[model samples]
Target: MGYESYQQLGVDVADGVATLTLRSGQKFNAVTWQMHHELGLIFDDLTRDPDVRVIVLTGAGDAFCAGADLNWLRNQLQDPPTPREAREAGRAIVLGILDCPKPVIARVNGDAIGLGASLALLSDIVIAVDTCKFADPHVRIGLVAGDGGALIWPLLIGYARAKEYLLTGNAVPAADAVRMGLVNHAVPAGELDATVQRYARQLADGATMAIQFTKTSTNIPLRQAVESVLEASLAYESMTLRSQDAQEGVASFLERRKPNFVGR
Candidate 1:
């Protein structure tokens, strides 16, 4: 299948805004390797697509992306990548969103957990429903919040707050998120699309190159931070993947019970 044959995503472009919807609602828009790779490539194509001036990422149904599919995670046991390989793949996904030339707005219609939280928070602007929640639960799954959480969280909320949330893997409500500087706006569920469209069109209609270049300029710090912190954090996360505790964590999750973690 071609790159256009993205199985896990749905795209609709109208009036210069491309709404990219995660279509796997049955799994709360969970990410698989394919979905993650598709996300990495979509940004590169959308950056060049003349019809698209802005991109808004959202999820179908009641929740935004919950996280990586547990089944997908379990399947990794069959053909696991090296720490470096996994980290590089992860880097691509995060950088694709950060480096996309078109303004990307996260329309967080509902729950944004784990990597979903990162995606929403990483966008140029995040517009979330009032009841939507954000959290990075990779740690709760016996992994570090290394993927994008460690990278983007501290940059938005302070290092102290980032550690508090990432370590505990607690859900932050939409209003609290906005108050803590984690998201740009929170509105009623009915107002989400309109609010996202209003801001997206404003960005699309503004001085195009100016807006794009401004995004480029402002992301310099973020780029530097990625180089400085992301790999090291991912390295630690990868180390934890090899632990017995990690296996138990997944098993407990699948068993629908509290994890009995004995630090190994």
Candidate 2:
């Protein structure tokens, strides 16, 4: 199948490794509405691409994705998605990653925050640069971490650890994330690309169907969690997106001041 021109994201294929790069780095590859929707669609195409034996996702610039675009967030604050739209969009992004038959690897180049953090963690394997940071700060923006953050973080770092970070919106350095079992490898910045290439080639050269089948089997629990939790979480998140607190968050972000969230 011919590839669609993924406007904000970039896709390149060589030696059976398809590198999907988030290219809007000037905006930290933040999730604009189009980029968010495209993200949901790309995985389905990648899953079927015979030329792509291994998939590596990373940002083009120093930062990975920075979550939702601030402009988009401001618009969302004023005109939030309808419950149905929110549920469907959020579910598509989450399920797109979970349902992909291929083993996707996240080459975490730098900061992976909010939904970006979810995207990174959804991968079959994750390799982070030692200086990269990981965080899900939705709550800080008066949004719920319902973008698969609730589904995966607890599964990776346990409920207590996940809550400690989720509730506080703290950033975890790459080394700390590795110690906490959140990422597979944390190598120096100089080694990031080579390490990802080596692993991608190794996987590309190995048992293809076996690895794919293994991914499917391992994702059963993930699929189940999505089935049970995603819709509700996204629904709640949509509701909150219209809340007074969410509006305040947008205002505070624009004003570059702390939000006075009164739990409205």
Best by lDDT: 2
**What TM-score fits each model?**
0.96, 0.97
User: Model 1, 94-186: lDDT tens per residue?
Assistant: 889889978999999889998888889889999999998999998777887877899999999999999999999999999999999999999
Best by TM-score: 2
Q: Which ten residues in a row have the lowest lDDT in candidate 1?
A: 1-10
Error of 2 at 154 (Å): 0.3
In order, the Cα lDDT scores of the candidates are: 0.86, 0.88
| Each model's total of backbone clashes | 0, 0
Model 2 residue 140 CA deviation (Å) reads 0.7
The residue-by-residue lDDT of candidate 2 on 1-264, one tens digit each, is: 566677877888888889898876457788888889889899998988889988899997788989999888888878888998888888888888888887799999989999999999999899999988999998887888888888899999999999999888899999999999999999999999899988898999999999889989999999999877777778778988988888888789878999999897
In model 2, residue pairs whose N, Cα or C atoms come closer than 3 Å (at least 3 residues apart or on different chains), thus clashing, are: none
lDDT of 1: 0.86
